[model samples]
Target chain A: MTTTTIQQDLYPTRTGEVPGPAIEREHPTVWGSEADGPFDAAALEAHEQRGFTILENFITPSEVDLYSAELRRLSADQSLAGDPRVITEKSTGAVRSVFEVTALSEAIDALSRDPRVLDRARQLLGSDVYLHQTRVNYMPGFKGSGFYWHSDFETWHAEDGMPAPRAVSCSIALTPNYPYNGGLMVMPGSHRTYAPGVGETPADNHSSSLKEQTVGVPSQEAVTEMAHRYGIDQFTGPAGSALWFDSNIMHGSGNNITPFPRSNVFMVFNSVENTLEDPYAAPTPRPEHIASRDFTPLR
Target chain B: MTTTTIQQDLYPTRTGEVPGPAIEREHPTVWGSEADGPFDAAALEAHEQRGFTILENFITPSEVDLYSAELRRLSADQSLAGDPRVITEKSTGAVRSVFEVTALSEAIDALSRDPRVLDRARQLLGSDVYLHQTRVNYMPGFKGSGFYWHSDFETWHAEDGMPAPRAVSCSIALTPNYPYNGGLMVMPGSHRTYAPGVGETPADNHSSSLKEQTVGVPSQEAVTEMAHRYGIDQFTGPAGSALWFDSNIMHGSGNNITPFPRSNVFMVFNSVENTLEDPYAAPTPRPEHIASRDFTPLR
Candidate 1:
């Protein structure tokens, strides 16, 4: 059949029409109507209600060491110095994030396809899943910066052309996360609401936004209302721990001023059925390393 | 409407079933049923019959100088040393190609949107067109490499998930295209046949194929037969001359042993009606720089 017809975009952001962040009902908290596979009943319920679930000891201590070593090697690799996939900190010039980790390393690619991780993603997305984006985020001890509160789907839908929030992100901690060392903070139950950010997304926004996001961030008033309604929860855990969260949930992290560093391997799994199309608001989509266009399911 | 249903792949290749190159009927040389715009009747008919058309002195001499200077500056940019968008020769470290030229330079971006070029693309594709890929290919004086005989749509369909052959490529010469130097050679009337190549496409094929294509190349017998039937034509012209050809035509070039360097800015325009989906043969889609996933029509 001919597919010349272009579908309408469901979630729109960065249109510059809204004066401030506007909250709207989400498409669906959980796409998979029934829970199965490795996810337990409580974990699935928590994911549906609170928009997130934490799994302790997702990897062994030795596995964590392997991943940490890989991350360190990737950070120090001189070959990736000026590559667009390697993002450095704004002030310190230290490697802040390494995008497309799976494509760059075979160890990470294997982990992405591991049934332990892949099964849960399939259960959550309610269909076969593909890697939307994968990266290793590093926050060095004293000079690491902070990320502002924002929904990933906002930027993804506006800039990357993601059709829906039928995607999930799993962050596997490679270093210990303490309360003072800039652990991730999420507004529980915020996944039920979609906060549309105000402003037009500039061309090549990812080059800057990945360093320090100034656009597609929810207004302070909107963040306060959401925080008051659901309350904020910080994810503090040991190495090898994992946190699975919805794509549209309100989340951010504070600066790390302590003596300890925090690093994590983040992987986003998107439903194969919900592939990308044209951008809804921005002039062009982000690079493939940041938002992958490949929809081949992880085997 | 929910798009959970995955469509059937129209063109399948690299399945390891075909023993040799198989020629099949093409979908359509001209999708735009009715042609109207800047193209004259003869030019359009030539495109339909011969699968290519050449416009002499498409850009003024001064404009050619401007583009040549831009291309030189881009080639010598130290900032793009290790960038994935920049490809260098396998033998020599000399820069060979620079992908995403429009995104890297404002002058080239404006050239891509010029009505003289964009209007013809829309007229031939029979719909609104978007920039599918743009790059500046440079073959230096002595050590220049040559491309093997292959149809681009085979790779685009097998690896980039381009559904149809409704795409056109415009190559504007930045330097003199002498017969001695490496210049594009095409078989007239070859675009009407879809020649399926043999062998399986390896994973991450673009990393190596971009430098020297070893896979997805039509057999030597197939090339000889096509050359005997349609006859081989070399594109030899002055700077600023432009050649527009169908995407699926059998084309390749010989190595430049001459002192004259041949350079051209290549721009590919795809019908917006034919956007990307999952790859039909390969394991993953190529990077966005090589094969764009964006479907936003040029306005």
Candidate 2:
């Protein structure tokens, strides 16, 4: 299932134009051992029911170290000045996120296009998937703020014209996640219900550091009720563990004001057949790095 | 038992010098109805056993409204520049704390020295009590960060030279405490066991906003073990409900990024007999507002 052909020129094109169809495959290719890669029928069934699945040892320890080192270097780079793709914390100028990682680092790009990852995406999504976004979130020590409780599809549906939640995000941990360090907390079976959140859009949705904080997060009443019905679970493990979640799952993380750092590489894959159209009257306000206009399906 | 002689000059004196003997009282004066105050033999027993007690309807609705209005005015005043008592959030510049509220606002001062409040303090402390600190915490919407899991006695013992944990804080809620709005969470029976935390002291111990975050908070393993043993409890109720907690109780608050504002008035009373002696060789690092050198007992 591994292919050498890469679609580097497909990005930065005009808005509303879909890139060409990806190289087709006969069947989903399985990779890794049974312990790590649960890319099987049972795994797909669980994802369909629960809206999330964890893949242990998705990458080797050495691979995680390499990715972490590359991320440190990319964050320290001053070349991408004033670029929306690179965002920092409000008070301390620590880099909070580096979007579109595929366009920058070769190692991260190669990892994103690994045959095993694409094969799993193909199996669950049940169609050819394209790289929607590649983000590296750096939850640095003692200063990292938190994302409020929200579902990804709510923002995508309200702001970007994502027709349906035919997408999934693979969050690859670059550091060991502990309870005190503020790892991701998700409510089980929340994806089964769609909560059109009650709020207006924030002024700038593209920025990693959300200053306005007007995004449609779950209401306190809703979170309390949902939490009561389906208890919350925290995602905590060693580095290289991968969490694949549905776009509509209710999730949030606490502020990381501890010594331990929490960093993750998030790659969002959208089914090529469910490509987005802008909901706004004007041009898509978000930059290419955040909400990509390029719908180039991957091989 | 109400004496009006306030000791405003006792502060700014040398750290080791006890100001003077307090106005002595023969027996503890009881106040409030049997249902609310519980200032009896059983009440002291409960305080000794549980380390915290909540006095429902501690203040009338009008009193809460008056204090809340004065607090709003104090927070809006721009003329208090260079005043170490007024501290703001490091990132947003929103007012996080206004220390020594008794010295700044008469309404808050009267509330702090109210007969009912003093009577209750006398019953549990078993001696004449002095005002250690008076602070109004303003957790405005969308910007309030959190205080990590820690005991107040740990900081007061290490930095402020508070000998034994013979102090209590009466937190009067200025706004209705809801769960999502970052109400305080305390571990029941935690005051019985002191957790020797692991960390260096923060540079600025006076500021409410923890920019340095070097204060010794409970470790992850300790919190986990204790949480399993005695589950955490959140304090939630009407605006006027007062929570009286021991200084050694393990407690912390969540971030208040929600729309609901969480404002509270915390009045810490130290036993006159257990007055501080400087732990450090140099003079007290913190200002008088945060840690008073005054030993004059309250009437």
Candidate 3:
């Protein structure tokens, strides 16, 4: 089974009405119409400077269809130990394991390998790249399946354990995700530019407590208080779209409040500098949390 | 400094007196009086059959006084970012970080190597072991600190992208934590058992909601039910005392209302099976509201 990437560009926009479920047929498109293609040297440079960048037409609408069909096929009788799905807490990742890995479809593979996704990761991390993990989120009843603004790498990068860090995440939306559908909300170009908000915890102790009074990581509240002054925007867009941001960037999403099942696959990528420790184990890097860099240059 | 271990024959049990602070000296002397230790391998074996083991003299009284004195010495300063003596969460073995590798005081060292501790863990895990992380909690005043009931290994064993299984956490309480002092209250042997409950959205979400759910492992209602039935004994022992239980065991502490601080240090241990994948991370594990395993053992 080949991995089908979500690279649809039915609706591309540099900025505007922020396409919702309603298709913008006769509506004037704000961004370029054609697929922007793989991230070029220009896109790479822009992302590093800005902390985040968006790739248009990263996957097609049909490809997203393929992802949904395959996901449906994979969700059969998945009850683990007790219920159809258990709701438990560990020290590490916030999981939804009931949605296990669906064998990557053909279209998914191409999208993950798409230079637009990998090269951008390479540019920020300063090294060769590889997919961290491909994940599919299914928001049932869209009643805010999940929402909380926080950093990703703070849990992966083993608090002050490794050297010369470079880590990044690339998210591709499979459906039209607006703020109402729990779209990815992010602080523009805020990735590599900012200092690690919350200090270091462990790869396992991600959500054990709030960020503020903990270790090296700041609390999400603290990050929000700071991000508010900068005017953060919700990352909403159409299918076949992509987002590249530094692992250290503070980000989160709203819950899908509507009947629509908001879905997205984060094709996370990291450079040699980022995954150097164990390639599979990244904890929060304290130095990055302290510098509080700016993200505009990467763009 | 020489690391000393707790003797096996000293964990304080009911000495025919009501549970109170002054009862510290009323328990029978097992180690110094005789070398039989906390309980013989046979008694421990029996206790294991019944679920839960008590290791006496886990830490010497003198050592407890020393650590408590050290906490008093360091807490005076306003800044506690990296001070090593305050006796907080890091002092408990949960999150792996920079200060993770340090001297294990003789008291802790003893508990670390306790045969009873090992025997119980071996029975629960059915495998070899690795030390995860350690921390100490000084719950003082009306509003004491709170922690979620979760497994250290289940939450933090492998790196985020890696497929390593979970490890387990072993909490060894040094003092007789009672309800009045807001001692720790845990679900009886919930680690070996798991059950999913009805999912509900927490009221607060402006912060680290996910992590809040993780550290606050057990729901308030769940713990209350277990306490009513099994009658959770608050961990309230004198110095050189300790109690061992499963990391994932559903549990939490009450407010510390008495004058003195409610003290305890948890040293986390993991099995070798917990390998890293992302070399730089351990993704945030799934919270209780979204895990996919059978965690309901209470029913």
For model 1, residues B1-299, the per-residue Cα lDDT tens digits are 77697776556667674534455655777766444678877778778999988888999899898888888999999999999999999998888999999999999999999988988888889899999899998898646767777899889998998899999999999888754456887888998877777689989999999998777877666766776678767687999999999999988875653345788899999999889878888988999999998889998
* lDDT (Cα, tens digit) per residue for candidate 2, span B1-299: 88798533211211222312221122222222334443776776666666788877888899889988888898889887667888888888877788899999988878767878887786667778899889898887656777877777766766677777788899999898865456787877777666655554545644642432434565666666666666666788899999999887878766754456799899999888778877432234566778788989887
Better candidate by DockQ, 1 or 2: 2
| CAPRI docking class of candidate 2 | incorrect
Error of 1 at B279 (Å): 74
Local distance difference test scores for all models: 0.83, 0.70, 0.43
Compare the candidates by lDDT and give the number of the best one.
Answer: 1
Model 2, chain B only, scores a TM-score of 0.83
Report residue A48 deviation for candidate 2 (angstroms): 2.0
TM for candidate 2 is 0.56
Evaluated at residue A72, the lDDT of candidate 3 is 54
Write one digit per residue (lDDT tens) for candidate 3, span A196-263.
43332355343333222234343444444445434455566787787777665656543332334565
* Share of reference contacts found in each model: 0.00, 0.03, 0.00
Candidate 2: residue pairs that collide: none
Given candidate 1, what's the lDDT at residue B209?
Answer: 95
Ranking by lDDT: 1, 2, 3
Q: Scoring each candidate complex against the real one, what DockQ results?
A: 0.01, 0.08, 0.01
Off by over 4 Å in 2: A1-38, A199-204, A208-212, A280-285, B1-145, B148-151, B154-161, B164-299
